[model samples]
Target: MDFERSLDLLWRDKGETPQPTRGRKPKLTLDKVIATAVALADAEGQATGSMSQIAKELGVGTMTLYTYVPGKAELLDLMVDSVLAERDLPGPGDPLPDGWREQVRLYADRTLTVFRRHPWIQGMSMVRPVLGPGLMAGQEYLIATVSDIGLAPRKAAAAANGIEVYVQANAALTAETAQVEQQTGQSTDAWWGQRSVFWEKYFDVDRHPAMTRMWESGGYDVDTCEAVDEAFVFGLERMLDGIEALVS
Candidate 1:
């Protein structure tokens, strides 16, 4: 992919690009094309969302879309960056707070928020890095926040990447679980309830003492299940503790 061209399409002044001389003025802008593609992908999985589908959504010919966006890959790139732009980070000139740990926590929460809002993004293959303006700014902010805590450049990047990966993976699991619940019309607790009869009948108490003890303690009860939000906080704090050890 031509990174420069993609960046131009994402961030540069649209008027600066030379207009076509012979053809009628294009009805669709790049933003419109990308927005339409994003909506299609959000509603349907990326595999089912195609150039033809986006064209139909925009009421334009498939070939005409090429005039605005080069192809699906580039369009995907733009879509990812466009969503990244929606992240409610601090404005350009604002200084990051000095509380590094809390800042990292907030960053992870924000990332998880993005993932939950656009669950389809968790499924996208990041084999090709799309360093559009929005993504670049996010990266800079994260690294700078870590660096402000006195970590070296390499460690800062690693720390930021680790937090991001943890948040994304957890958020993806949460989203998938929600999707399953929606499709099956059964909550996790309801599914466990359905299986409780069989479990009571055949559960091996002698062979699995630990499992037996946990069940007796009501650990498997629906009300005892760890909330997703609590799990996230617990895991995040533990991760930060490890990083804090290195910092100390």
Candidate 2:
């Protein structure tokens, strides 16, 4: 992953770039390269967001691009961090939203916005964090919000992590649903409707008591992939309620 190079570039300031050893007078910055990579990934898919493709998009040679950044691995770290900055939430010095729950909602809302904007990000693995400023900043903001609710520091971090876990999974679900529609050329409703026979002809109430009960009890009112957003909202609120309970 070009670990050292990626780590160094991750912490580099926006204006700071790699010093190009004597050559044709450096023509690009690491930020610009990463920005182009992000744009490419946003417009096309991540597969097309490679180093060669980035240089093609930027109208520069791949070697020239390499001079600004080490390799695709390093550039990806920068791109993920860059896209994450889109949240644009209030950070350390700025005032957080009214209540702790409200602040958490704000975090959820901003995160969903970015995920929807860059659905490609949903497919990527963040198994290891980039630990860049953009990521650390959001982490700091959420930790502060959770701490404000009077939880211990470690617990506050856990709450923030747990909240983000749900948020990210919800985002992946929604994004993948969209991806499926695009790939299969069938909208979720149409795809889901094609399987209605399973419920009508194959589903047996006696075989699945909980499913039958929930369906009869109107618990499936917001069911199905069509109302995924509403379901996510309900789940998020319930999660917040649980967190609120801890302090109460």
Candidate 3:
């Protein structure tokens, strides 16, 4: 989609409900189309989420959806911005809360929340980012928060990007793990147990002494292992520590 068209759609007022037209009343509004598409993506995933699927979910013809959204690519851009609009980030003028580390931690946590809420978003290509208003606002908030601290502009921007990458990568893994558990109807421990049996049968422990030792030490046991939240916190702190060292 062209930049102008994307900007128009993303910046369109989603608050005002669609009004009845002169001839035939509109069956689907832009907000409805976006919401329905989000629901479809959440349920069926991005790969299976198609124009026809969204149209079927909304009980409208495929061509009808085209009037509201040009195509799946444009629709996806809308969906991304729509999801980002849900973020509860502090405004640029808002003061940094407590220590810089704490503020950065909060930022990471909030970003993770968005990813957890929309797992399918992780699948979308962020390489060529769609700089919609919602996403731009989020970036502004992150950079502002970091810059509000002692970090210089360049460092602050880099730090914010680092935090984002960490949160997104981990959130994607966590979401995938949850999806697997849900589909298989098995907890992580149970799934690991099944895999362990296969490893015990055919795997040669002699070849990988360190891995074997770690497995024997209960490092691989899901029941006793650190929770995802704990791991995230630990990793986040370490990442912050590195950034702090740089600042010092």
Clashes of 1: 0
Off by over 4 Å in 1: 1-4, 13-23, 45-47, 95-98, 178-198, 201-203, 206-208, 218-226
lDDT of 3 at 227: 63
* 109-217: candidate 2 lDDT, tens digit per residue: 8888887777677777766777888788778888888887878888888999998889889987776766566656788778778899989998988989998898899
How far residue 50's Cα lies from its native spot in candidate 2, in Å, is 2.6
- In TM-score terms, candidate 1 sits at 0.81
TM-score of each: 0.81, 0.88, 0.82
| Local error of candidate 3 at residue 78 (angstroms) | 0.9
Best by TM-score: 2
**Each model's total of backbone clashes:** 0, 0, 0
Candidate 3 lDDT tens digits, 90-194:
776676667777777776777677766776777776667777876877778767667765788888889888887787678777666655665567877787777
Q: Which pairs, if any, clash in model 3?
A: none
TM-score, candidate 2, is 0.88
Error of 1 at 98 (Å): 6.0
